[model samples]
Target: MCAQGTYITCANSPGQNFTGCACGQCAPPGCDGCVVHLAGGSTLRG
Candidate 1:
C-alpha cells in the first residue's frame, strides 16, 4: 500500500511487476488522483 503522501506508478507493460514511488501528495479532497514531478522537469497528472 502507498503511504499517505506518496504516489505510485508503473511502466507500460503487462505483468511486469514494477512499482515506482513519486514524492508528492495525492490530489486533495477525494484523494483519488496524484501529481508528481518527472525527471525532465515535467509534471505527471493522473
Candidate 2:
C-alpha cells in the first residue's frame, strides 16, 4: 500500500498527480486529491 503523504501519479490520465494514498485511483489534472466512494457507502479521499 502507498504511504500517506506520498505523491501518486495518475494512470488514467497523463500529467496528473495527487498527494496521499490513492489506492490505485486516478486523480484529475491539477488535483491534489480525489473523492472516492467505498463499498461500505462512505466517501473518502482516494
Candidate 3:
C-alpha cells in the first residue's frame, strides 16, 4: 500500500485480513483487481 490514494492504514482496518481490498480482492465499480497476495487465496477479477 504505497500508491497515491491507496495507502495502508492499520487504524482503518483493525482485522488486517488479506481478504479486504487493503490486502487483495478489491471491491467492485470504483476499485477492482488491485491485490497484494500476502498469503493464501488469489485475487478476484472484476
Shift of residue 13 alpha carbon in model 2, Å: 1.7
Q: What is each predicted model's overall lDDT from 0 to 1?
A: 0.40, 0.49, 0.35
**Model 3 RMSD, rounded to 1 decimal:** 11.1
Clashing residue pairs found in predicted model 2: 22-46
lDDT of 3: 0.35
Candidate with better TM-score, 2 vs 3: 2
lDDT of candidate 3 at residue 23, scale 0 to 100: 32
Pull out the clashing pairs in model 3: none
Q: Which one is best on TM-score?
A: 2
Candidate numbers, best TM-score first, in rank order: 2, 1, 3
TM-scores, in order shown? 0.28, 0.30, 0.19
Give a tens-digit lDDT track for model 1, residues 1-46.
5433343333332233223344243333333344453545555665
CA RMSD, predictions in order: 11.8, 8.1, 11.1
Candidate 1: misplaced stretches above 4 Å?
1-33
Compared to the true structure, candidate 3 yields what TM-score? 0.19
Model 1 lDDT, residue 1, Cα? 52
